[model samples]
Target: MLDIAEELNAWAAEGRDFAVATVVAVSGSAPRRPGAALAVDAVGTAVGSVSGGCVESAVYELCRQALADGRPVLERFDDDEDDDDEDGLGTGLTCGGAIDVLVLPVHAAGPVRPVLAAALAATASGGAVALARIVTGPPALLGGALLVHGDGTRHGGFGGHPELDDTVAAEAAAFLDAGRTGTVEVGGRGARCGSPVTVLIESAVPAPRMIVFGAVDFAAALVRVGKFLGFHVTVCDARPVFTTRARFPEADEVVVDWPHRYLERTATDARTVLCVLTHDPKFDVPLLRLALRLPVAYVGAMGSRRTHLDRLERLREAGVTERRLAGLRSPIGLDLGARTPEETALSIAAEIVAARRGGTGVPLTGAHTPIHHDGPLGVGSPA
Candidate 1:
């Protein structure tokens, strides 16, 4: 939903009516994740995607239906079978996967508008927000919604059951903290078991950070790629003349500070990526010593084999352990034989993606692996 927030907010400001269809759950080899969404405005314009193109036509029709009915809907699409089109409308999944989608009608003047407005505002402000909807519940409760903001305030009300609403809000907060979008099942009494109520929590947190510890041409190239890949890129260097925003306009920020000191003062999480592009011993040694010990998602250093070896020795002497050093990907990027800065940036970006998505960095043509792997919930084991 955050992916389409800017567009949706524009439509909302224009008082345009629209409907949103979000993939709430998936099984088998689904192409998209839980937060994937598609929205259709009254004029028949659509944005975003739920299942690539397989189930889009069907979901778009559902969105139109939702807008007309002025209510929310929970629709499921499954792998195609001989009898899958029994309904005669031909709305069946062609892909070999199953997905559950929540379709909600939204308008400028409606019960759900506040939630949509709040969601857009949260993403715009770079704050965290989550929306929970009853995907599977009693008829009256189905599609009931709640919005939880970063400051513990809530917007739309949930199902009439107070206990269930409280439980869903708490679960949404936990998922927001973990930066996850998934489903949670709760009982009527807000406990773990009873009459099942599946709440689909869609979250929007600030973009993951990519901090490049060098203000060089390679850093500028990497900043452009990082921004294209949806990261909040920052270029930091102690040399003020080299660390100007004019040099790296694509970067979200240009920090004129020592890499290690700036990193110590910044907020980083498990999704943050630290790139040490400064191959010089004076800058690389201490910056890497600090990065290797942190719990960041990826830490890579740009250097030759000899430089990497010397840096490792310096880090070990600075109290970085063998296990900690293992986290570093020195001589960074894949074996792309990249000579230009743009190509090197591409290789580095590819390696970062492969690491995050558990890819092997091998050519798919000769390898045997799932074409579409499991998503956030870890439903299907990777092949």
Candidate 2:
């Protein structure tokens, strides 16, 4: 969706008329999840994809028709023919995958321009907003969604369902706060035609934060790698001399505050990543203390074997429990025998990716430990 929104912004900036096609529901095999999008410019150039290639061309044609006819439409596709797995949708999927898609004519939400503008603004700043589009079975959620947390208060929404408005708004707020994309159950029970409705909660989070708490050369390399990976890199150190903007031009911010104090200020899981390259007890001891307390997605420490052991002892003495200490990825990065600082950054980034994805590729259901060690273990997810 972010990609589509970006392309839309570019198109609108350059004065191109376009429509956005989205996969609103699925009954069986699905190539992409719900809320997947594909932007269709008037002349048939498309960006992003809702289905592999199974339905993109078809969806684009429908978008053109909607643009001409001036009314949103629902379409379906069934590639149940003899198309090999590699030929078309990339699934080589000749077997069978049916899908339900909606082609919405994206004429700015009215005052459509400002409404669309507000949604884009939230996305630009990495804020959260829900787009409640009514596609299947009625004129209920036709207008748009009440985009919360942006330039304006209430944006667009389903016409005339005050109860639904309240319920969906509450769910939308919860999804935005968590920085997640999900579908909530609501609307369709009351007198409004009773169609089981699905509202997609799309989060417009700023680029992820990558905070390196040391000003070493490793920190510089990590900042470069983090930027390549789309993180809003920040290199921080208490030493003004070591931490300079020249070292990391890619970094969104650089602070001369103490490592521990900075963690206290901004250390939530969604917006923060603490990379302790300082490797100094004076630096890492306090930094690690504050990092473990928060629900950060990744907290990695770069150090030698001896340094790792010593740091663990300090954390233990600081009254950090074994369970919490277990989460501390000392000697961070995968066991890829990374020798150089660059290789080490790749290895660490790989582990961080796996952690965020919540798996080590090891089968949790087959193993004896807890599913996540935290979240739900992906039941039949590919290895």
Candidate 3:
């Protein structure tokens, strides 16, 4: 699957056959979402995970079986009370959820290997691509796949009907545009007359951006955290001497331009996060004036209470609206009583994640709220 594309791409480059088990659907409280996968090579080596360890062994065996038989298999694992085999050998999820996995082999002579390999390569290189596979359909088309690139070009087909291939490609392109990985239900043969087919479209897009507008020590630590959270982090500052690649090696880019000037020219989207660690009013005021108006996911500034109040007055004088100012997270990061740079960076990253994931930034120890939230406040929510 595209989730483990880097490793699987290497396997394909080496001409090693492997079986990939991808989660096509889930019901209830499943750990992994659609497109999560686990792959096993012909030599018994495994990489990646489909269920975070709950149903890994069973899925591993399924991958091995798929590799041996050269046939695709769809298996469902669910929590069943009737089963008494409690040695942990049962494939049920301990979280009481259900997941449907589709296992397909990628042998050297397989018809779909080239398509899969091309998808893997594109995904590993951070290019936009989508892999659409038939999760539920006729036996002949069960594991058929199509690779849709960002430019709307495609490779491979279901081989069932041209209409079906066309329909899936369009649907996959839509998913790719949205950077989503999930399933779409369509009638067999691309019309509503026959049995329904569920196509799992796995989309891979470049990571979202996290622009840290200060080359301070805290920014260094924050860059590491941002990378760990799968962000394309950039560190920007006006001072050339302070903003160097050596100071922030983990950052994807180190830009030596005035914060506001650089941000004006660079690109940002709803998923982009802006962190203004340059507490100086000269830098913070101009940069934040532009940042607060942009349609970005988060905009936080690092400063003390007094500094924040003064900065707010300066922004007010700079013609920023109250509505726009409300979006700023001055004194950035949750109140963690953090003193060290690393701890402060952790707190800042925590607040960013909380905003993106719809968390309350409160202790979960005594809270009765749902551990996972899937509402409008999720990633890419209105900023």
TM-score of model 3 (CA atoms): 0.94
* Candidate 3 ranges with C-alpha deviation above 4 Å: 81-88, 375-383
Query: How does each model score on TM-score?
Result: 0.92, 0.81, 0.94
Q: Candidate 1, which segments miss by more than 4 Å at Cα?
A: 81-95, 373-383
* Candidate 2 total steric clashes: 8
| lDDT of candidate 1 at residue 378, scale 0 to 100 | 24
User: Cα deviation in Å at residue 193, candidate 1?
Assistant: 2.9
Checking candidate 1 for backbone clashes, the offending pairs are none
Error of 1 at 186 (Å): 0.7
- Full candidate order by TM-score, most accurate first: 3, 1, 2
Please, what is the whole-model Cα lDDT of each candidate in the order they appear?
0.83, 0.68, 0.89
lDDT of 2 at 173: 70
What TM-score does prediction 2 earn? 0.81
Kindly list the per-residue Cα lDDT of model 3 for residues 79-171, writing each as its tens digit: 863266567366778888899999999998898998999999998898989899998888888888899999988999987589999989999
* Candidate with better lDDT, 1 vs 2: 1
lDDT score, residue 74, model 1? 83
